[model samples]
Target: MAQIVISRFAPSPTGRLHLGHAFSALAAHDAARAAGGRFLLRIEDIDTTRSRPEHVAGIFDDLAWLGLTWDEPPLFQSQRMPLYGKALSDLKALGVLYPCFCTRAEIAAEVAASGFAPHGPDGPLYPGTCRALTPDDRAARLSRDAHSWRLDVDAALALTGPLVWHEGDRAIPADPRIHGDVVLARKDLGTSYHLSVTVDDAAQGITDVVRGVDLFDATHVHRLLQALLNLPTPLYHHHPLLTAPDGARLAKRHGAPSLASMRAEGVDPVTLVADLRARR
Candidate 1:
């Protein structure tokens, strides 16, 4: 019996989907199509402050315009707060999560004062300042202070032992501490990307995770989260990003033009999809 390949393309509704997003969505869709399997769509609108209702509607419209469809209705992260909360509670019971009350400025100052702080994929890692808080102190702070919840990576690894994740048949060693004490829940949102995405993948029974190379390193953290949460890790494909002629990767922050804007300019979705497939 052949194994059914399931892939997903998750996009945040913070902005419109760009060429880079198009390439990723098409890649996942085509992979599932080629395998005669399931392709899922996930709306990663976890950042409530930034996510907009209009952008969510735009996601459906743009994918429809591109003639892309999914095996099931999309999963929305905003509605799954309790699932994430339960995962947090599970980790809390495992004694691997801690309350982090340090603000960004305080963390930066501590790192700067250290003269030689360790760096990760996203600059200086958290220095574990709050990890050393006493129980009574933590409780007192928890009473009045707005704080994020961070995974104690060292403690988590001790519980899971050494770990690895898969990309195709390749078994990449997982560095659980790569992102050092990554936030599992933000002060404002009860869930972070790593925690929510890890939980959702299992919920959707996603078999293959297809995403851009920019997140390749983050997979190490995701792999760790999967282990801690006792969820299955999916096979991964981190595709190279589509970049501008000047060599910058296409991104919303860089003001990359979106598929909706392109369509408004009379760009043919069929032609664009064909071009994207050729590039793939």
Candidate 2:
């Protein structure tokens, strides 16, 4: 038999747990149980501006209501800033992180000038205006003003060989052109989702990652980060997302029905499970 370890369901406490959240958590729990392994819960509350402590309690209550229990005290990202900082320092020491000075408006202007959106998760691809700066030029900029830190794809890839991952039945490779150099740290926030997530998964020793298919495209980037940090790449299983009747994915801002809402409406746990199982 294969070595079975731990799998985790990490949800950001920026919003209440929804049906989609319940599905992902259940998937992780079931997989770990089937493998005779451990299940863990982690709070991806790195977004300090949005992640509230009350939301964290709501998540725990929702999961508990579903009979889903984590192995220990939930790991919170905000408390792990030092670890993220160390990882950032490691990347910087390896010359894979550079400062980014371009603001949203500046990048928008560049994108408009280019007549196309640059390639990135956010759509406005970074123009790489700062990528060409010399060491002294970077120092001068750093000395005069503040800037976010971005990962240099070429440098990171060169250090870590090919950036590829197994996405379900297919093997995916990183496309630098599309992903470009993603931000690792903002001037205000110390860590980005890509950096903190990869680090936390490794720190928690997650052997399998159960999430939605929307994050399938990001698997390659996460794989690269794992390689860079010398961490194990967990088996990824991206399930179909729960969308609205009109074929739109649920958004927190839209006030989509959360698990609490559904339960309050007398929807049973079995109903939720059956609904998701029917999708697959």
- Among the numbered candidates, top lDDT falls to 1
Query: With candidate 1 superimposed using the best TM-score fit, by how many Å does residue 176's alpha carbon deviate from the native?
Result: 2.3
User: Model 1: which residue pairs collide?
Assistant: none
Model 1 lDDT tens row, 1-280: 9778999989999888889999999999998999999999999998989999999999999999999999899999999999999999999999999999999999999999999988998999999999999999999999999999999999988989989899888999999676889999999999999999999999999889988889999999999989988899899998889888899988888989999999999999999999988876
Q: Which stretches of model 1 miss by more than 4 angstroms?
A: none
The 10 consecutive residues of candidate 1 with the worst lDDT sum are 175-184
Q: What lDDT does model 2 reach? A: 0.83
Q: Count the backbone clashes (under 3 Å) in each candidate.
A: 0, 0
Q: What are the models' TM-scores?
A: 0.98, 0.93
Give one digit per residue, the lDDT tens place, for model 2 in 1-280. Answer: 6777688988998889987787778888888898789999999988889989899999998998888887878998889999999999988888888998888888778878988765666576687888988989999889877799998888888888876676656677766546788888988888998899999998888888888888877777788888888898888889887777887786676666898888898988777777775665
| lDDT, candidates in the order shown | 0.92, 0.83
RMSD of each: 1.0, 1.8
Model 1 lDDT vs. the true structure?
0.92
Q: By summed lDDT, which 10 consecutive residues of candidate 2 come out lowest?
A: 168-177
What does candidate 1 score on TM? 0.98
